[model samples]
Target: MADAAFTQGAETADRGRLWVVLYLATTGLVLLLMMLAGLWMRLAQSGWLDTDPALFYQLMTVHGTGMVGIAALGGAAVLWHFLSAHIRLHAWVMGANFWLFLIGVVAILAADFPGRFGGAWTFLYPLPASSQGVWPVWAAALHLGGLLVIGVGFLIWCLELARGIIATYGGLGRGLGWHVLFGGSTKDVPPPTVVAATMVAIVTILALIAGATVLVMSLINLAFPSVELNPLLAKNLIYFFGHTFINATIYMGVIAVYELLPRITGRPWKTTKVFLAGWTLSTTMVLIIFPHHLLMDFAMPVWAMAIGQVFSYVNSFPVLVVTGLGALAILHRSGIRWDLVSTLLLISVFGWMAGVIPAVVDATVAVNSVMHNTLWVPGHFHFYLLLGLLPMIFAFMIHLVRVEDVTPRGGDLAAILYLLFGLTFVTMFLVGGWASVPRRWAEHLPEWQIWDQIAVITAAGVITLTTVFVAMFLARTPAMLAKG
Candidate 1:
């Protein structure tokens, strides 16, 4: 009987590991493809490639949508893998989400390539309908419909996670340690992973709902030309959804740090009042801070703009400080060994913290007036996503395949190269913004091409190193899965 039970447990573990492996593998492949597309765009802008302007916009649409979508999927895998240890999760829900995501990707690609839907991923209202005859109405509808499908899949994923957390912890509030924070209960305070997952589930659910509303509304207007939407309201909803959804990816990816860092340092990451407060504060602030994206809209109300600027300053600090300080406290004098995974995890914290500096600067209304439409916007996001969030995801992938914690030959070299080139790439964007270079233009002036040319070189380096990392993971995955 005992042997049978042991076998059953091992099988369950293998199944869970298999799902995670699938998720990471898909993420790595899609990420590489997206990076290549980005490289192509930079090359075109640099006059190194002679791509058509229409094709440039199409690739841009795919690059943006693919990167954001895959980030969320990868983050969900990390969260699910760790969070399952503490709660009961239905693995079928995860599998379903993956299939739905693939279907959505197919629809998006078809709409963009064959159908020529060049509207950006934001699908900002009326833009899809007013493609100036460049794209058909059906193409716009299909793209919007594809986004809705993706949002629905993510919504289901978050709901399942919420269900598991609630069942185990008694409620989302308890999962976030609201009871411990307010009721002063010393027993049963959830760990850092649970706290983070709870926050993600809450925010992602809300963000997806907002995204679905906007997508559906846009689809309706696409089919029926007479149905008009208030552009201001559409922008608000879209930014609220887009900003929150992307931000949640970082929050989800950070779970890898919370779960892995303690193991590396031989310490436990406990949930404290400070940690709970930080997450709770962030939950509120993240929802309201989306308005900062609309500060340039003169039609927007004064009160909303005030909320955007004021809360932008406040929101950047809480969870970051708690997580950053917590990691430091754990690593201090703990004699943690360094490896590719551990090194990347540490860099991720720094990247996230540093990324906030530029984001906060842009969030300020006065500074935003001049810099809102420049490469500075991309600079800020790429800093956090490339250096911060992607590192967390990559570290987790490397962690899964490692039989031991020792760094492989040249692992350190690869990591250092990634950081060096990533920093240079984003810095060029910041510099371009400083020089008032506009973003999202397929063609560049001769003077601006210098920056684009430099970025092309740095971006290639980053992509080559990332390819190495992903290749390593793919090669070792079979052995790791078999061991499970």
Candidate 2:
């Protein structure tokens, strides 16, 4: 009976690994396409290519929406693989989510390309309706409908994950290590579980509801032209949803680091009282911090804006003090080999930390009033997403594939080039932002063209190096899996 039980568990693990591979492959593909779309927009801005303004915005919409979904999927893949080790999750549920997300992507493409719906990814209320003959009302409805389906899929996944955690660990507090935080027990909770629990708890309630509200309002407005919605209310809900969704990506990435880094370093990153405290604080701050994005809205209450600044300031401490310090300590003189996973994960910590600095600065009311609409906004997020988040996603994938050697051919060069160009590209945006260069412009003035030109070049290099990295992984994956 014991042997049979062990065999059953092994089968479940195999199934989980298979799904993780699928998720990673799909995410990489989507990211590649989205990167190209973003490059096209930048090239147009640099005067290297002539693109119609409408087409430029359509590409922007696709890039923005698609990249967020891809990032979420990459993070979810990491969490799903690690969490499956501790709890039983239905493979079919994850598979359904994947299919729904793909469908939504296709629907978005249809809305943007043929239908010419270019309201941007936020699909902010009234803009979809106010497309001014750029797109039909039905196309707007279809776009929102796709998003609604995606939201429903995400909601269900979070709900199932929440349910599984509760059933396996007794309750949310137990799973989240609240007992340890309160000095009640230092028992069985692991850091990854705390991440999973906190993320699921916050996102299940906040992101899904915020997403549903915006999508529903969009569909209603599309269906009933007479039914108008408050613009301020819609903006608030949409940004709340957007902020929470992206924030959840980082949480999942951090959870992956917690689970995978220890294995590479031959160290045990056990859940501690302080670590649990950070996550608990994160649960509250992440939800409320959305207000920082809306600080430019003079109509928004001063109290909410104040809350945004305060929480944004406080939110930096956990990642910097706890996760960053803990990672440094783990890597310090551990005799850890600088393998692909280790190298990428270590750099990802820096990327995340550096990205947060700019984000925190921009979150300040004074800086935000000037920088919010500038290229600096993209500079910070792209730094975090491209430098911080993508590397973590790749590291997790490499871990799953189990590359036997630390040194894949050309990997060292690829990593160096990727970092060099990615940093340079983002720096250009930051400098441009500092110069008050506007964002979301299809064309740039002569004064801004030099920055865009440098950015386009650096971006191309970054994209090329990323392709090399992906290609290296693909080349190694077959051999690694065969060995297994």
Candidate 3:
């Protein structure tokens, strides 16, 4: 127990912290850019911006690509820190992983400018393959190539981590992670969650491989001109990749919760049991939920739909039960200190809860009918993304950095204001979604105009509140970086 802190190596913290700082700052830059694009999109639709769709798609494409690339796999670089610091693993391959990740991000961004690939990040076929006799098809190929390289980087880092665990557990009968969690000697290995993370990495590798294969084929067809595009195969491959990749971030978020939540409140999570079991559950169920994306398309059979919904409902249970509620349990047991990280964690729980209700209801055969493509879809995602993943990322950033970690003196007031702001976003999205308001629409029917106004007003509130918070953080960040 005395060595628990040291178990997370000292030098690794400094090294890992730099990566975290880069990741957090880059992610912030991406979000700031996205919000600007979103504002522009709003303006253009209202005829306020007078922008062309091509340029709009360029910004949107970069924004989506950047967020997904980092938000999803940023944790790949981060996993090195988790291993080296907490598990006392070697860092031989960490920097190498970062280099590859950077290469992929740079390549995709370069190809996305107006000349080569205005295909948008979705790369939604046929259009991406053709130029309208205007732009060449090579642009699509370039984007896929970038994703391929990033996937390779993720796999290499995972392998390095697994090897470290094997080294620590040479003769021990217990799992490596079990040894670490129970306060075993330096010779003992990491706990179950860490061990499960290796397996999650394996799943991510396969999903990406599947996606890259189909994407590459589509690109190759452009040159070959005779290759057939199988819609079924393409859809399956992309979702398999998309679902797993997005969930990868959630996996890291979950791990962070188990590791950091207890420490913040001076709580002990058995350091022994829940961490291992919870992650094991996550590894198993998460694989089955990918089919939910296909539910909107009717090409699949009823059995497929039923099975998808069932698994979709079931898959998130582990996360909702073990990580979400469990966080509060530990905090309740330990007494809440209400720090910035703690506040983010608390909000993550609420966000997860918010996502779960609509999601569970929509999973039902009856409700899925009304909620399938409407504003309800956005309703669920905002809660999931804004409340769940976004806050989770914020919590991770705080833990991963050294910015005083202080909430303002009036943070409780800030929390109330922020919560109301988020709720406004959720509420408007729900109203529009229920009214069958089509999303990504520039303007709507006269009846929908009121909902649109509500949406704009709420979104404006969110933008205002978020900008304030961001400015505060940015103000502090330069000083924090200066310290380093």
Candidate 4:
């Protein structure tokens, strides 16, 4: 433990540690808040009770912005410590980065409800471009400024990664840096986590900042509709950011799982190299392949769209197959008894694996055009975001608690029940998405009503699960709460 401590001072390093804690708490709060609100809105749509449609839009906007922010900043924070291991006073830099990230979160959350009441979290330029009537100019400015702040924080951290890799391995070249930093493996090859994290950061940040630039240009285009803000390019920007965010979730979650699963089961995951290479290839390809989502939008070139479809299919499915199955192969040979955390982790993987079929199929050129904006998008993503990413966060939290020997006071059974209800019902939405039922619509024609019904039911179940999980956390407060 002493050697594990770096040259950084106790106070500064502790601040960095606190930042990570705050980030997770903030992330969980935002996630639960968004899901719970969504569930409520769905319940109202189902005729149980009605909530304000205006407020519902706010919830949607907050959800998107919050989730993206969490994945980018919070996810990076998780990897930062590993990368910062050798940096002297990395704690101070980490602490500052964390605060800046939190500042961004607060700004976004604050801007969401009050700003024009636009429900779209991605902001989809030209809509939020104007601030005269619906929302004041100040609000839009605040949101953009907040995003810029967050982006800068991450940019600084990436520089840290680059510097740290050089210090450790004597030089930072291409391919991979994270695996090398995490473990002292020297090689011409880099590890999957390093490649994924750094690439996700690079791709998403550049795309988002470009989207921001387009946003500014879009303000001019608002007056000149013919001036085209590159809706196609804008859509690509979103895909670049959105896809990487989801992938980063999987990448970071895998890193934590790889580290902890070994300690828990007394068996390290096998074929680490295969899993690493698989992720490296997949992340690189996925970065360029997001144009696949635009196949249905006829404005784009047919050939480009075709390339997207091919790459998207290849990137989405195969990586998970090799890596996920490889993980199972490693786990299968392990003889140790499973615990609550291990169960949840494996279950999370199951949800991700199951979710991929619909996502992969939906990305097909034929299917995407039909199901592009439907409940299917939500259905497919809930698997990756909710079941895949959320469970990892839960499992990681539990790992922290258990390692510290914190008492299992609050959430023993409640967490399990929540997982059951949450996942079992979320699948219904995936089915609806598969059938081409549109999402975010309050009412649709008879053909779409069936899918809407399923979504509503699933959303309500999520609410109930959220309530249970919250209760469990509160219950365990006395036992788990402690100081570093």
Candidate with the greatest lDDT versus the true structure: 1
- After superposition, the stretches of candidate 3 with alpha carbons farther than 4 Å from their true spots are 1-13, 45-51, 54-56, 73-80, 88-94, 116-120, 125-127, 130-135, 169-196, 271-278, 364-366, 399-406, 460-484
Please give the TM-score that candidate 4 achieves against the real structure.
0.83
Model 2 Cα RMSD, 1 decimal = 1.8
| Candidate 4 minimal-lDDT segment of 10 residues | 80-89
Q: Write the per-residue lDDT of candidate 1 for residues 1-484, one digit (tens) a residue.
A: 9999777766665676678889999999999999999999999999999999999999999999999999998898899899878876777778888888999999999999999998888888888999898999888888888899889999999999899898889999998899999999998899999999999999999999989999988888887889999999999999999999999999999999999999888899888899999999998899999999998999999999999999999996999999999999999999987778888998899899999899999999999999998999999999999999999999999998988754587676788789999999999889888888888889988898898999999999999989988998999998887876
- TM match of model 2 to true structure: 0.96
Tens-digit lDDT track of model 2 for 1-484: 9999888888767776776777888887788889999899989998989999999999998999999988988888888877887888777778788888888878888988999888888898889998889889978888888888888878777877887777887777777777667757756665555555556555655787988998898788888879889999999999989988887887787766787779878898866677777777777788888899899999999999999999999976775567887898788889987767777887788889899889999999999989989999999999888888888888777776664565665554566677789899999889989998998888899888898999889988987876766665566667765775
Q: TM-score for every candidate vs. truth?
A: 0.97, 0.96, 0.82, 0.83
lDDT of every predicted structure (CA atoms): 0.91, 0.82, 0.64, 0.61
The lowest-lDDT stretch of 10 consecutive residues in candidate 3 is: 171-180
Q: Which stretches of candidate 2 lie over 4 Å from their true place?
A: 1-8, 479-484
Residue 266 lDDT in candidate 3: 75
Looking at model 2, report the run of 10 residues with the lowest lDDT sum: 190-199
Q: Candidate 1, TM-score vs. the true structure?
A: 0.97
After TM-score superposition, the amount by which residue 304's alpha carbon in candidate 1 deviates from its true location, in angstroms, is: 0.5
Report the C-alpha lDDT of model 3 over 445-467, residue by residue, as the tens digit: 56766655555566676666556
Whichever of 1 and 4 has more lDDT, that candidate is 1
